[model samples]
Target: MTVSVATSSRDMIEGALARAVQFPRLRYMGSKYKLLPHLARAFADVDGATALDAFAGSGVVSYLLKAQGYQVTSNDFLNFPSAITRATVVNQTVKLTAAEVDTICGEPADDRDFIRRTFDGLYFTAADREFLDSAWSHIDLLKGHKQAIAISALVLAAARKQPRGVFTFTDLRYDDGRRDLHLPLRDHFRERVEDYNRVVFNSGQTCQTRSGDVFDLPAKSYDLVYLDPPYAPPRDDNDYIKRYHFLEGLSVYWRGQKLMENTKTKKLEKKYTPFSYKRTIVDALSRTFEQFKDSTIVLSYSSNAIPDAGTIKDLLGAVKSDIEVREIDHKYSFGTHSTAQRRDVSEYIFIAR
Candidate 1:
């Protein structure tokens, strides 16, 4: 029989506020922001005051756990999400005040900026590029979560200006009159900062952010470990690095970054991650389970992804005594293009103890 964990008073408060508190509006494709309610229900029985969010993409899961009174340690290989996690989860009380926002915005824009030199007409407007350089300069000077909050706002602004809410190559064939392409950069940025600043609250615990491979985390026993790695699509590329590499560059301030040659997309040159590939997924899952076997594991995966649920259960079975899978009906964050494929899908949560 499947036994679920009980929710605390903090959990009840957070669950109610989860609907009220708006998360940073990110355009990431596979974000679990919409599924937080279902996820909270699935893991309600897990024994944990502390959690390690192994693949904290978009940081919604980590932030939610933090709100529910968990001491969350959020890790993602990319710098962008790590910044968000640091700002929202790890941050106990630091928030960007209204006066600070004005100071950050009033910083001088450099024409010969790194973004202008590197990304001319690639992802953003020349003006937008210049503003970003100025924003980065001021943001880099600040320490800790203050910097994180500003950076998060900038990231959100950049993503909003891009088509399809991602950094993929845009077709300029019929680009005669696109209003969104010409939206005012600074105004949008200010609005984004205001939006992010409004949501800053004390999660009641000091969290942490780590950016690197999942295996490299400090060997310590967490009460629970949540994994939400990239899904291996059947016929399309779901590689997040390729999708959000621009944001990564922006997070790192594009210092001495390597760019892909002969490609219009201008994605950053990145090393291959096994979780982004189909053939290596089983090995990745097995290794992760083995590495964190000391803690209760909660894995979020799609019903129609690589390795299949049975394979995953078998892999988890080797590491833990009990395994339970919960299936929640869900839909894609972005609409499906194929007429043959339905928009509806099932999201599976594998719980192991």
Candidate 2:
């Protein structure tokens, strides 16, 4: 049977992104943080359901589902996403006090000054370097949920305030030429901190964000698994996630404060053999779906095509006897942009029984 979950809450917001803490400065395409309401409406009948949000990008969909009271198992391959997903969907509770917020905002400016005072030869600005160092040093005083919320807010603020707009991933830093961009330090930090405070005080959802490959998840453990993996293929000669290396670092840190570079991966995959031409993704995913042979499966895709809508249905149809399809008009055209990608976003919602 197919169920849509659109139940309501008053002015309720998702945890991490609502605080703008997760992405910090990432402006990547197809981030679903803003698509929650639409997705909520789309999956409205999914009340009291169990879900396994596989890709868990921003955990927006997962958070919304949990907000609507779905039993959610949110997972991601990246650390920042895993941290964000957990901070928002799982550990989200209304536990911060006004005193904590006051303390966070009121940390001695002297600490920041000390950290930044040493910012002679560095990537970020003097103020930014100072704030980051100060923030990290003071983290122990932040308690449990407050620490997560503050860090989220701090990262978000740092990202927006960064002149180069780079937060996690650093390809190669230039000593000069960074001055071409200027983000006002004070206003940006305050905005991010405020957002951090708000999200900590607002969210209440039961969720978990784990860092691991999608294919590794236990089969049939989730009532639903929303997949939005990278469409770009990865191989010795294919293109893939290049600007997202910082995400790897973040996940490593979150799993228990370890910072180690992945020297194992020597180069980027520069080209993609078509999905049909290569059965790797489908093979692994299909194996996963077999475990969910009795659960609902929702797949979201776009056509820089991995498995287009029709093809996906055929794959999913192998498991469920009853399947329903709904397509949302994801309008991408915005006016007055010299370099805005206006690709059509036709999200196919497949509900299988």
Candidate 3:
């Protein structure tokens, strides 16, 4: 039975991707949304009834796999990305109603600007801070995947408003005269919610999301296990948790949570992960490959990142036969300003089956 890919669901995905906002227009440090077409082509012949997106950042890769009729198990360490996974991958057709959006924005039971009080003068404007404080507080009004969708929309709104799409530093300083900061952030939140709602369609699969360390979860046989771990920086710790801590706070609704001070950001303590350490990259990659050795593995990495493509292929080759390395000229999320540096970097996709 040849099922046509030209159905209404396919058209919705095509239209959303073609739009200016892009599908799931999420702002993350190392998202592979733009590289999905290449990834799809790379895994074209590898038939799989199920796929496990081991490091499912932004849930775009998992959503793409679900769109292609694969039962996807999207996993992320962060609660924010897990919310995105729930909304997009797990919940196939549920979307927020206008009334629900109204409640989420208008009445959140926040008497004080919780965001302002906690992150005073750090990230957003005073008004924007109040909006977030109220919005996230009321996110619990809805239940199940709808709440996750709303909270994920809030994460998107916060990231879009933040300069550079990272929460490492306060972008909305009084002197930093950026135009994006001047807009009404609440409006952006509503717009993002509606956009996400519009893009929702049934992928017709019992897709799901798992939140926590990939190793902590029980290993299951998957046709293809996609891994796109946080890139190991050359020096210093650059974990995703540190970069997007604000989203983490929002996802969990930072209330009564003990926050330790981080010297780098001076906002909140950064969660430590071994995968982001230069000394542990080889060992971490080796363990990950061994854990998923029973399944076909596809790893996404950057040419400029630590361990390089040669080292990664060597690691995977030990556990799986038929290792293949492919590269596409790519630009970094932060290193796009200098033409020379941008031209030099390449995105590497390593396939081991």
Candidate 4:
């Protein structure tokens, strides 16, 4: 069944974005959110197409596909990436009452439990920690698809109350004295069902969820393979996946683990692919493209990290009969301005047939 696309719902847009004031999700130095509209325009040829976001960070692109009423299949090895997908792209309509929000977020709970201890000395005010301490526990008792949906909502709420200041890209809330919750995630979920009711009520679905490398995608299974792998380099002598505490945190949130304090070391299982090395990067992408075979291949790459636009074009042309290159013009949302104040970025879209 087709879920009605309600892009014009202003209330949901307001409620859903309560957390947007902070670290909402799937964001990095080089994210695809700014390019989302352009990406959608480029894919104008695609309708009712089953879409896949292989590297579903923040699930923004996947959510975009979902918002467009496409059958979106999002897969990301990272924990937070998948969580955002479950919350925004593949969530169920939640029937919530204002009383439920109060019980879930406004009340007090034990702050010295394992979950609270996990975030000790971090940025979450005592009230924030207690809220999550109770809320996550409540969400955890449920099972199956409902679990994903509940946790998605709960995490958005809990992450806001965290000491780390709602949506910061930085590590901890009080680690370096930055304790302001940039975006109040709790405020977003406080309204819960009413926030994005019109949009999220229809619910979204995905094909699979696996904890594995991007190169492990099955052969000849998907119609389009969307790749949004990491653009950051690994820390000195550490694996790239190991540095993925952000992802693990989201996974833990899925399990209803409330992290009240930032810690010396992030706790979770980290997965990494051989993406930093040039040969490995090419080989892995080549294999992924090969597995899809003839499927319209659309890639999201940054001008700063991935191969030059020309190299990508040549590679795609060699792999498919047709190649379409769209230089997603730099806009206010995607950075790369003529001004000298903020960081600049340029992204490219390569379409292969």
Best by TM-score: 1
- Please give the lDDT score for candidate 1: 0.77
lDDT of 1 by residue, 109-186 (tens): 433387877787776667787888887777877898899888888887877777756666655432345565567667
Top candidate when judged by lDDT against the true structure: 1
Candidate 1 weakest lDDT stretch, 10 residues? 333-342
- Between 3 and 4, whose TM-score is larger? 3
Query: Backbone clashes in each candidate structure, one number apiece?
Result: 3, 17, 0, 9
Predictions in order: lDDT: 0.77, 0.52, 0.75, 0.53
lDDT for model 2: 0.52
TM-score for candidate 3, residues paired by index: 0.88
Task: Give the deviation of candidate 4 from the true structure as CA RMSD.
Answer: 6.6
Per-residue alpha-carbon lDDT of candidate 3 for residues 1-353, written as tens digits (9 for 90 to 100): 33333232544445434431346767676788768766765555465667899888888888777766677899987778888888877887899989888887786575756677777777777888889878867876679989988888888888777876766666444335565555677888898898788767786778889888988878579888889998885544456766677777788777544465544354456556678888887899999999999988888998878998888988998998898888888766532122314335799988899
Ranking by lDDT: 1, 3, 4, 2
TM-score of 2: 0.69
lDDT for 24 in candidate 3 is 71
Candidate 4 lDDT over 273-328, as tens digits, reads 66655546666666666666556778877665545567667666667887777765
Model 2 C-alpha lDDT per residue in residues 1-353, reported as the tens digit of each score? 43333344433334322434333334443456555555555455444457788777555666666665566788865556665555556665544555665555555533434334333333456665555555555554665555665555554554444333333333334224443235544345456556544443233335566767766676555555666655532222112233333333323322343323343322222223232234575765566567667666666655444556786777777887877787776644222123535666676667766
Candidate 4 weakest ten by summed lDDT: 332-341
Candidate 3 has its poorest 10 consecutive residues by lDDT at 334-343
After superposition, which runs of candidate 4 have C-alpha atoms over 4 Å from their true positions? Answer: 1-29, 95-99, 106-112, 144-146, 157-198, 203-211, 232-247, 253-269, 277-279, 331-342
